[model samples]
Target: MLPAPSRPPRLRALAVAAAGLVVLTSLTGCTQIASAFNGLQQNAVSTPAPRPAVTQAVSMPYDSKFTYDGSVSLSTDVADGLEVRLDVWAADPKRTQEWAPDNDKTFGFAVNVVDHRVDEKAVLTQKRRVYMSMISITSQVSQSTIGQQQMMSPFQFSADPRTLVPSDTMRSDRGLLLNTFQGGLLVPTTTIHQLPADTYGITLQFALQVWVEGTANTDTSFQQQTVYQVLPIAIFSPTTPTQ
Candidate 1:
């Protein structure tokens, strides 16, 4: 056969360079695709699962004439080895059912003290005896209007709790002796009058001042302390019927 026409040196060199470029381009494309797939796999393994949403419930006001639970019990162990209990209730359930804004509401309450470290019968004579000195109630309304009056007290109460007890009971400047033979002290009822016409709810805060006996069982080495309790009342709308 006739000698094949020899390709020029320049043309042969160009063909070799183009083949190498094609191979390099193919390898670079495969590398890029592998890198992208690996990134996706890593994200799938490292990502956290989605979480559920959370929500809260809201409290609504009660009807003014509705006869709801009027009693609440509160206890405090703030004093060492002493447990103070407070029981509060509507003075008259019937009256509570008729309660409305711009009217009076009455409440009854009692206070009792117990010593877990000692017997109930001996709490009075024990060194850990608790005595009541003063009791008071302060009020706050949920809502108010211009010129609407606030209530201080429907009737005045003695700042001294001892006055509420019988004279035959143990006498001390510390106040009224609690853990008495009778069990506890009761305030029959107190009225709150002329609430703000726009009030939807009322909160009454009671504060009790007491003296806790120290290490001495016979002598009056007492430390003063206060116990607090709160009561919330929902007022019915004047136009709404009992429901």
Candidate 2:
């Protein structure tokens, strides 16, 4: 014969146990699926892209040709019997960087009494002649421990800094040494005149000096080359009487 029928209370207890199991599964879903992530992953949400490279501006110790159209009027007898005057013009970015004593000191294109040719006896056949300049290049790089706050390109190359003396530096002897140099340079006004006019096929070769301490680190050098030629002009004869 069969056993007695199950009680209602016994059925109710079985239903409650089944409901508890379902609740436990819902609360701990990760625990059951832990094995699915055995191979782990580690990555940042976002990444920065690499920047493109840039090229720096090349300067002295590497010779380059520049064209000029400057305006000036020279007085024949000035600067201890030399023709001296002023010029207002533009120079090549490369060349201006080469001549400045301190590149940051200025970016102005001005004039000076930079040339002198003696007429001793044989004077030019014309007066008021438009002149061409055969400039010799001098450059040096100064490197002082830049204060952490320093900013901008600190190199200033200029051929005529002595003339730019603010009233303060006018009487200074060491002013040129302190003010007119990268590390140090001695660009006498005569350097421009001494350049060879041997006519390397109608080109005037000027001297270029190697500067150190700025950016061209090693014992750098600038080779001799014809940088520029002047535009020809006819002027009143230098030998003409002062009418």
Candidate 3:
């Protein structure tokens, strides 16, 4: 094997100088790189949180036979708003059980959509419809010591554009009012749920969702409103009728 050639002094010195320059450059660039990373972290932390979405809740009166008559309306700055009304009545089934010999038995309630409308301003940029997609009813009953009984999706109430009809106002005006929609949601008594007895407190909750028109490329603006009413129910008891 041939002996390794010894490096020239000038070349060795030049190599040492290059190594020193690399070390110097690394040391100088470290602070700038760290500062850049820190700036990004700070900027990320300083970003503001988003605003909360719009939601409204209203309470309704209680009826032993699950009857409600009310309306809820909400307005916005952009001329897009929603209005809903319901007048429901429960029929006396006159159902009799061996346990209770009474004639004031109620089977279920009937839903009469008094009025539901969506008013919006004209948006020439995009085409849209004031769509009322769904309606839900929730029932809850509380007893003295038996805890509480709640049903999240009790009474399946469904509505759509087909269930609604254009109002007289919308017919009078042409394309000028592209955002107005009006109709009623009528639910038959067959769709309602039967009431149970021997409960301290009973409540019925109603909710509806609507899709409002928005910008062409952006997602639609959704608005939902929920309202509940207390149900005055008197439990039938042979031992104690008021119980």
TM-score top scorer: 1
lDDT of 1 at 32: 41
When summed lDDT is taken over every stretch of 10 residues in candidate 3, the lowest stretch is 169-178
Candidate lDDT scores, in order, read: 0.54, 0.22, 0.31
Residue 50 lDDT in candidate 3: 38
TM-score, one value per model: 0.61, 0.17, 0.35
Write model 1 residue lDDT over 155-216, tens digit each, in one string. 23335655544454454677766653423465544555555456566766778888877652
Residues 189-213, candidate 3: write the lDDT tens digits: 2322233343334445655554444
State residue 97's C-alpha deviation in candidate 2, in Å: 18
Each candidate's root-mean-square deviation in Å? 37.3, 40.7, 31.1
Badly placed stretches (over 4 Å) of model 2 are 1-80, 86-106, 112-130, 146-243
Of 2 and 3, the candidate ahead on TM-score is 3
- Maximum-lDDT candidate: 1
Local error of candidate 3 at residue 149 (angstroms): 8.5
By the lDDT metric, which is better: model 1 or model 3? 1
Query: In terms of TM-score, which candidate is stronger, 1 or 3?
Result: 1
TM-score of candidate 3 to 2 decimals: 0.35
Error of 2 at 194 (Å): 32
lDDT of 3: 0.31
